[model samples]
Target chain A: MELNIYHLYPEHLNLYGDLGNVNCLKRRCLERGIEVNVVNFTDDEKPDLNDGDIFFIGGGSDRAQQLVYKDFLQYKDVLKELIEEGRAVLAVCGGYQLLGTSFIDKQGNNIPGLSILDYESKYTGDKRIIGNIIIETTLNLEPNKLVGFENHGARTYSKYQPLGNVLVGRGNNDDDMKEGIVYKNYIGTYLHGPVLPKNPHLADHLILQALRNKYGDVESLEPLDDEIENKAYEKFIKLYGK
Target chain B: MVNVRSMIALYAGKFSKQVLKLINSSGTALPGKLALRIDNNFLDNIEEKCDTVIMVTGTNGKTTTNNLLNHVIGTRTDKILSNLKGANMIQGIATTYVNNTKDHYDYGIFEVDEGTLRSVTRYVKPDYILVSNFFRDQLDRFGEIDNLVEDVYTTIEKLPESTLILNVDDPLVNKFTQLPNKIIKFGLDLDLDEVQNSSLSMKNCPLCEGKLQYSSHVYGHFGNYECDKCGFKRPNPDFVVSNLEEKASSQMITIDYGDEELVFEYPYTGIYNAYNVLGVFTVCKQLGLSDDEIVSAMGDFSFHLGRMEEMEYKGKIIKVILTKNPIGLTQVINMISNDERSKTVVHILNDNPADGEDISWIWDAYTICEREETVLHYYCSGIRAEDIALKKKYDNVPLDKIKINDNFKEIIDTAIEDDVEIVYVLPTYTAVFETRDYIENVVKSN
Candidate 1:
């Protein structure tokens, strides 16, 4: 079995350790004896999204977001079509803001987003909502509490299917207690402790969904030992799990 | 001359300083904060009685370089004042002056925090301002690197009288142009022959946003480079390192200054320390101190705890290296990877407020590679121990070689279990002091 991972704007939008998603997926696949290929789209390369089973996007600085915006506008439609065809994606922080309708930047500019989902973010808060964040997720996975860190100045509003409800830390906005948005297999989130390494179930879920996209009607993945991962997850749960 | 408000503020601040010292506390910022609270313009009298004042600012190496210069200056004159304990913000700087204002000071040397540079410079006029190289540090507290650079540019550009001692290697620090202030640049000329991992992959020129072309790559966006479109290029540094050899206990740095070749022997061995040494060396030379005197002062000095502190435990060398940000972490990894001694590395990552609550910066750094020859087991220990353990696994380290234990004592004992020559304990800000104290206890007990 093989999986193709498409990474967007690796140079510009590679902030906040978002590569942990790519690493988690690749490790899980390799542990199961599956071949994996990671294809990166830099600012100079023209992206072809068809062959990719899973797409990943990470956060960047405001200046970096502005630089990646030009490419996001060019490929939003193709990516939307791919997501509709069950291509799994995990976008965090600045990448999450970019997938929405529009987002206010650090300099108070209300810049347009790719609008792949019906959501928007505004930079109105005097202080950035930042800290370790834990969420009681809406996903039907076992032990569905996801823990990570959130650091964003903008407040996002999404009425669509949310990835989770905020158990701790400010989520999508300072109000509403909503966290990330989920459309099919596509997850747009603000959790960036990379949001994967410690969340083994979420990482495996994304990997399983991507494998299903490539090889249709695949059975559940062969589980590996997640003792270290579970211990890491439990620490965050104990700290912020109330 | 006799403003009762300023007088009362000074006396109250001095009284608190004594009381705090009597209680055996190192709380350096409180008295200054109290003084500022009592009299809003308490720092307005900063340069009133000082002869030659110098301020140091950067992401890293500010405290070390300030203390290095202070040691060299102390050799010449006893009339000096400094924030030696590294409470280097506006409040701490105010406390230094409050505690030492009884007599006229010849040199009011200070290490100014990068965030509080504008606030400190507004009242205290410096004769020289030394800018060490800027790196990715505490992004949650200080916004973007470009924005911080702009903040520094706007403040130092106005100080036309002060000499700006800058590091020419960092394209970010050297690109500040059209300033009326006298500029002296110091840079490294030799290659380390190891991994040329630039933590920042910024390909564009910092000044014109044009494409920057590098002739030689050192560490992070620090290299000899030129902008192809804007014609901006690396300046010829006033003080240049022609050669540097890292010894067991010391490093011999040879600086090529015109016709004279001066060798400075630093008692420590970190590549970043070479930059710090040069920043202070350039300042001392400009202050008319001879080359030999500067070299002797730097060689005889001792570093504060947790900055690559070496200890012996059961006939094994344990180095306690304090790493705060991504650049520092990458450098520590790079150093351990380059060492030929059989060793173990214990990485302690903490996400406390002091360590910057966001642990995502760890992803920005390059991982260890091809160090299996001398490298042994890796232990990840701290509040966020498993996070770094996951990082190691993702870095392609075999899972069997990586161990995760949040307990410091247990990990340290396990690391020293082997017949390894050295064990390097790399800890984040919050874990550094505890790790150092534990090692001190272990060494004392043994």
Candidate 2:
């Protein structure tokens, strides 16, 4: 099986090892004997959003996010169609905010977003939600706790259902016990432990979704022994809470 | 009255230092922290006490470059003060000043932390300031690289008479040359053996937000870059590493100052250290150090501590290197990968207050390390051992080969027992001390 992943604005939006998500996915696939091809779409290149089996957009600074927003607007309809088709997608931190309706900065000005996810993020106050985050997530159909780190000023509020319930660390916003937006095969979150490698179940889930979406049938996938991965997850869960 | 407040602060610093020594502690930062609390004007009084003050600040290379300046300058004169202990915050500078106030110093060299440079500079107005380069570091402490430069700019704006030494290869730092202060630029001007590509941290031009295109991509968003849209490019540097040749354990290079050229062998490997040397050479040349003096000093110089410090551990050769951010870690990984030794690598990670709480940078560093075929066994240790292990595992290191040991002693023992002839140990800021102590006291003694 071949997996084609399109990294959106990787040059601009790759911050704090956010590209590690892309590396984790590619390496995991290769280790599983799945051929992987990654194509990076930066400021000038226009990648066919349809050609990609999986799509990834990592976090960046506000300036970088704004620059990417203008470029992303050109493919707004294509991205919406891709989401509607239930294509596997992952967005993190600033990229997660860009999937929303808007992101409010410190100056209280709204930089409009893609509006793909039913959420809006605002600066609201000065305090940034930063720490190791663990959440009870069922993206794999089995109850599991996902671990990661979140550092963002924009507090998001979503009308749609969240990806998981917060066990520890501030998620989405301070008031809500919810974190991330999970719609169809699309996932957006503030969890930037790059959010994949630390949580092997989530990485495999995304991979399974991408494969199922591509070939239309995937038997219960052979599970790679995740002893170390699980150990890492449990370590974070024990350290952070829950 | 012998300035009773200053006297008290000095005595407090001295007493704390003695107590820390009695307790067998390095006490790098706490003594200064206490002295500053006792007297706010402690650093100010010391600044008045010194004849010349040279301040260095940046995310990385501050300690290495500060050591270089102190070594060269102190060789000529005994009356010099420097923060050799890597205590670089406001209180730390205050502590250094309070301790050194009694001695009549010709120059006070300090490695000022990026976050506290502005506040620290308010009192100790340095006659010369050297900014090595800026990278996204200690994100939990300092927000962004863009904001960091502006903070340093505010400090530079205040020091109108100070000569600002800069690294023009870094576009982010190159922007500071536009400051009204006297600018003395230094950069690498050699044909890079490999393409120098910068990290995602520096994609857009600092001036116009236009994309920066590199003619010769050197390393980590550093190299000869030009913003075609804004016409902003790397300015011509005065002190340039005209040619650089990387050797097994050192760098052989020719440096050019105006019309004069001096060939020197820098006793350090990696372009990262080359940049540090260039910063030192710039200040040394400005101080009128001749070619003979520079060559002699650099030949005799070695890294202060855990910067690629090698030792025999349990009858096997082991090297310990201090790596902080993704950029610096990438360079260290490259240095290790280039070496043809059988590599049994041990990574020590800590998320203590000193090490950034966000451990995302490990993911990037591991990505680079994964590219190397030299690594045979990998051990992850320290507080964030699991995080580091997960990174290595996902990077395609076989699960069985990757070991996560929170115990440093066990990890060191395993590394030593492994059949590999040499083991490369990579550690973060806080982990460096613990790993060094373990190797020094445990592994070596055994």
lDDT of 1 by residue, B1-446 (tens): 66688888888888898899999876778889888988878887678767899999988888788888899989999888889877788889888877874567788899998889898888888999998877778777776677788899899877889999998788888876457788888999965444543236566677664777888867777778899889888888988988888876678999977788987688887688888888888999999999889888888888766777788888888888888877778877767766778988888988887788887778777656456767788899888888788777778777887888888888987887767999988888878877888888878988
**Second chain TM-score per prediction?**
0.92, 0.95
After superposition, candidate 2 runs with Cα above 4 Å error: A106-108, A138-140, A217-219, B193-201, B313-316, B366-376, B398-401, B417-421, B443-446
For A102-165, candidate 1 gives per-residue lDDT tens digits of 9877676788988887899987846878788999889988788999988888889888888899
Locate the minimum summed-lDDT window of 10 residues in model 1 chain B: B192-201
Best-fitting candidate, scored by TM-score: 2
Q: State the DockQ, from 0 to 1, for candidate 1.
A: 0.57
lDDT of 2 by residue, B62-108 (tens): 88888888888878987888888688988777667656745578888
Model 1 segments more than 4 A misplaced: B1-3, B17-24, B191-199, B367-370, B373-376, B398-403, B409-419
